[model samples]
Target: MVELRRSLSLVSTFLILFCTSTTAQPPAPRRSRTRAYIEVSCQITEYPDLCIRSLTAYIHGANATILSPRKLVHYALLASQHRAQHTRAFLLQVSKPLKAKKDQEYQAVKDCLEQIDMSVDQLSMSIKELRQLGREEATPSPSRDDVVWHISNMETWVGSALTDATTCLDEFPGGVRMSRMKATVKAKVLNVAQVTGNALSLFHHFVVRYRVPGSPKKP
Candidate 1:
């Protein structure tokens, strides 16, 4: 009887351990929650599908609980910066084989390369500002004005990047509209512009929703 009672007690203990482990939320639930959060946040953009596609990978492993609104904006900007870098590289490839013709069409391609380069630089500055914003928020005592200031600067930089991307297509004369080269460049630049727009929109959304840690209303 003593041995039987000990065996029964061990079985009860094992059952308790199994139940405790099952009570905690598993990784699959965390991953789905994270994905859902990203999808909802991207709905604010004009190109929601594109926004989700670009951003989901950035926070793929992170749980939804840890992703603050500011972090969402940061990840969006990172996606924009990456898109701009890739577009710039593509522009360089497009420029190499073309002869330096004096025509407007050829010159537009040349101008686009410079424009994308500028966009890349602008995005780099914006990405740095995002990093600064993160550090500022993580402080023991963060200032409201400082956070607003950093966000404002980032907005301006991203806006400039969007303009730069669109201007690549603008330099072409009306007659050369959507020529083969221009069309090729347009496809790439348009991608950059859309992603930059997504980043800019995310900033606005985040700022509107952001509130001080203890404040009842948004700052």
Candidate 2:
């Protein structure tokens, strides 16, 4: 009778400890506040899903816990830059095997390689200009005009990247034999263009909502 009572007590003690340990652990982390904010901000873009996905991946890779508007814009541009670079590499690799074919499709791939390379450069420049915006703003005698010019330059570069992607597709002759290669090129280029377009939209939103350090105030 005593052993049975002791066994019951041990079981009760184990249950109590288990419950206490579980309850003492911190609650599961809630959805990231920054992710929620990004979702809302991305709604302004035509490709909201792409925007969110790209930014979320950036956030994860960067482990960016705190972010400002400029930082957010930088991240978006960086993501766009990465996408363009990957597409460029893909084109380069695929073109290697077709170099000897000397066909129309080979010619198309050659042209696309040039345009995508250009697009990669434009995006690289955009990121450079974005960083320049911050440096210009941080100067002791910051110039509103300079900041405006840099912002304008970023917009133009991003737009040009989009344009370059389209030009790449236009180079591929219609109804070609290399439909598989052409389709892959089309998809990759379009993905870069769409992501850049979303970044462009974010640039506008950043301009409207968060004034740069050197931006002029309304009279």
- Return the TM-score for candidate 1, rounded to 2 decimals: 0.73
lDDT against the true structure, per candidate, is: 0.77, 0.82
Give lDDT tens digits, candidate 1, residues 47-104.
9999888887765544333256667777787788888788778777766666444455
lDDT of 1 at 113: 83
Global CA lDDT computed for model 2:
0.82
lDDT of 2 by residue, 1-219 (tens): 999999999999999999999999999888798898788888999999998899988668878853566767788888888888998899888888788665556778888889888888998999899888878877877677887888789888888888988898787655765577788888888888888888888888777733645445321
> Pick by TM-score: which candidate is best?
2
All predictions: root-mean-square deviation over Cα?
Answer: 8.4, 3.8
